[model samples]
Target: MAKDKLRKVGEVAPEFHLYEADGAKVSLSDLLGENRYVLLYFTSTEEKSRCDRSGCPLKENLEKLIELDVTPVLIDVDPVEEHKRFKHDHNIKFLMLSDPAMETIKGYGVYEKVNIHGIEKEKIVSTAFLINPEGRIVHVWEPKKIEDSIDDIINAVKKLKGM
Candidate 1:
């Protein structure tokens, strides 16, 4: 992944209109609710185990995020059906959005060319971002692995709410 291409803190998040795993339409504007923040997690389908382990913390602490007025969302290039299956399989309580076109994935600079079993392909490199209601990226929880990022996200949220 090109560091220069990645969206940074304070930058306005790129907008997109995507569908949830259940096929419901959604948009960045819709999630940026009044006085709230948006927590976005871009997942990798090829690394489902990683996805599950990374997502559990979010699922576990979902109520805390809600109480803090932060809406957590997951984005992946998987199809609506795949997303539906993954969501169901993982018991994800947050909105899992589909992005088969990779529009938003590339827009957010998370899309990368990766090698899988000797085949090179494009996909999102599991990422998380915390965005303020104003549409700006307040923080990127990618300084470490997915596990640490999730913790950082929650701690960052709590810290932001206190500010």
Candidate 2:
């Protein structure tokens, strides 16, 4: 199925339902009630180790994210089992969710078919989104590499908080 168009800032963040690492269901509404903002990264499930190396920048900007009190969420577009192991192996403390059906990925408009090893493969765009207390997308990060500097995400959250 074709993914939805990229949403703009001020639009209500797209709602999603996916399995977290522990098999609990997590949705946008659940997060909105817990924190002032949510920081999300969409990644591929087939590539577990690579997801950390490519789809994430939290390692580089974790402190900044914490400073802004933004709840970090990782969305793995792979299988739930893969995500479970990935979370365990990495000792992930933040929210980690799996969306094997790609419904959530498409809802966020991050899934795309791209050339991989000379073959077309479905993958998520290396992107992140920050949603505010009101559920509006306040920031977006689309990097050439999955591991972009998270300073931007932190700054956006800080700015939003100051407003």
Candidate 3:
């Protein structure tokens, strides 16, 4: 999908039912509740390691995020088993969802087909979305906007919730 077609701030975030690292099915609504928020970060194969900048930023601030009632979810095209190994390797306790079928990735307009080593593969366009309890996209961090997204997300949630 094209970048322009992505779900933007103020729109209702797309619904998804994906498997977590433990192979448990989880839906978008399952994570929503009174005073709860979701910070979704899409993963890319470009990151050399699970503990790279892409994953650690949020992991580092996980406690503060939970204190604010926000759930940090990292979605990737990898399989559930891969997500499981990632959690084990990196000590990730947050939700790491698998989207091997690319359902959620395409729905969010973050899927792009790229050839690596002359073999075509589905890749994710790095993106982040902060969804409010009502499932509305309140904040978005596209590739270029994510220099310090963990901080930006926290501040956005704080500003929105009057914290």
Best by TM-score: 3
Give the better candidate number (2 or 3) by lDDT: 3
lDDT-based ranking: 3, 1, 2
lDDT digits (tens) for residues 1-163 of candidate 3: 4576788989999999999989899998999989999988887755525375555777778999999999999898778888888789888889989888888888888877788999988777788999999999998887533445778888988998898
Model 2 scores worst on lDDT over the 10 consecutive residues at 44-53
RMSD of each: 2.3, 3.3, 2.4
Off by over 4 Å in 1: 50-55, 115-119, 143-145
Q: What is the lDDT of residue 35 in candidate 3?
A: 90
Predicted candidate 2 versus true structure: per-residue lDDT over 1-163, tens digit per residue: 1335766677889898888878898988888854568887876544346645555466556666776777888886666676678777776678888887777777778867878789997777756788887788988777655455376666667676773
lDDT of each: 0.81, 0.73, 0.83
Residue pairs in clash, model 1:
none
User: How many angstroms is residue 127 displaced in model 3 relative to the true structure, after the best TM-score fit?
Assistant: 0.4
Candidate 3, position 39, lDDT: 89
| Candidate 1 structure quality by residue, lDDT tens digits, 1-163 | 6467789998999998999988899999998977899998887766545655555666777898898899998788778898788778888789988888888988898877888999998877777889999999999865434556766777788898784
lDDT of 1 at 116: 96
For model 3, name the residue pairs that clash: none
Give the winner by lDDT: 1 or 3.
Answer: 3
TM per prediction: 0.87, 0.82, 0.89
What clash count goes with each model?
A: 0, 1, 0
